[model samples]
Target: MSSLPITREQILRVAELSRIALTEEEIEQYARELTHFVDMLSVLDTIDKDGVPPTVTLTFDPIAQRDDKLEPSLPRDEALAMGPVTSDGGFAVPKILGGEG
Candidate 1:
């Protein structure tokens, strides 16, 4: 069993560091939930996996990848014609990163 225990003070400290405002009820609830999570991890620590190979994925089959091939693309004018909005022979999209649209 793990000697370290999750406490309400720890939860409150974490909440404060994360700039999250929690009610007294919420603080108590999170303290219990976090403690349970740590207890579950302690249970995993009791399991013997010394000889087990670390698994990156559940499947044993080899991954299949499609062969990369050079393909002809549509002409610039034809491709631009398909766009909902086009400017200067290219598709024009709304600016998303706090820049001029």
Candidate 2:
């Protein structure tokens, strides 16, 4: 797949979606940067990878299992005492986007 060329409108839309208000100069600079990045990615997309298998590591026998050891955790009451607001043995945080309280 080919990378797309970014436009000013797209940048504005992205800024709106991200809830960031960008100045005119910043918008222009970001649009140019994004366009250049897409162009570079287009060049990368032309490389051949037909026979290559995707793997996280290049070395053989890279996987190893470690010995598991039991570790003592803080007492339940002590842990709960550190929380700002906890209930039912769990930390309770405020709603992230103001929906569920």
In the range 11-100, model 2's lDDT, one tens digit per residue, is 999999999999999999999899888877787668898998887677687578766977887999998998989988899988888687
Global lDDT scores for all candidate models:
0.85, 0.85
| Among all candidates shown, the one with the greatest TM-score | 2
Q: What is the C-alpha local distance difference test score of candidate 1?
A: 0.85
TM-score of each model, in listed order: 0.44, 0.48
lDDT of 1 by residue, 50-79 (tens): 999988777778887767988788989988
Measured on C-alpha atoms, candidate 2 has an lDDT of 0.85
